[model samples]
Target: MVAVYGGRGPQTSNIQIRSIPSVVRRGENVELLCEVENEPDAAISWQRVDGDLPYGAESYGSILRIPSIQGGGIYMCSATTRQGIFDERFGLVIQEEFKRIVKLFIVNNISHSTSEVGKSK
Candidate 1:
């Protein structure tokens, strides 16, 4: 089969965050990946909708890394091209770390002893 090529066909601008995390632990670090499909030259940018990016955060290309959860919130990823600007929003929730408690019971010939470890407050 033979194929014919056309000159600079119409293109649709699109952007997305690939496999972005919706929930993050408190004080935990997160990395968000922004992708622009069909437009490699399109400029991509990231921003936090509720507040500024986390302190010490880094951004390059299609990646946005948050050093910690102090600035976790809605994030916006935008891609700009000659057609227009495409953007997507990602929601991140910060949750307090949960602790699991375990209890051990020991029985002797005539006595029983109980102990608890890492009890949650």
Candidate 2:
């Protein structure tokens, strides 16, 4: 007698992105963590939807790290298993911090031997 068997592993339920910030400041490093229901059974990968990931971007099994993010865009993480595939997206906004410069004016009074300093931004 001969018997036939099918080999299949457990599938992942859902894909989740953990510790993702809605807004990130420029020149700051970003680390995206992808989580799956059955983590051991799923394979995870990361990429940018608009284009290729920024320069110096690294992707491991479940984490994607971008060094000093200069631009912001939509990023997607997908989980694949023998049964199916699941995906999740995150919108990251890059905030440019405005710098304020201070101008100071100094007035020296020789007669009074005093000095006055005024500051302005």
Using lDDT, give the best candidate's number. 2
Model 1 ranges with Cα > 4 A deviation: 1-10, 100-121
Which residue pairs of candidate 2 clash? none
Question: Best candidate, TM-score-wise?
Answer: 2
Q: TM-scores for all candidates?
A: 0.68, 0.74
lDDT by residue for model 1 (1-121), tens:
1122345764565677864457778888788898776778888898888888878888897898877667457889887766677788998888777788989888767777898998987
Model 1 quality (TM-score): 0.68
> lDDT for model 2, on a 0 to 1 scale?
0.81
**Alpha carbon lDDT at 107, candidate 2:** 97
What number of clashing residue pairs does each candidate have, in the order they appear?
0, 0
Q: Could you tell me how far off, in angstroms, the CA of residue 4 lies in candidate 2 after the best superposition?
A: 26
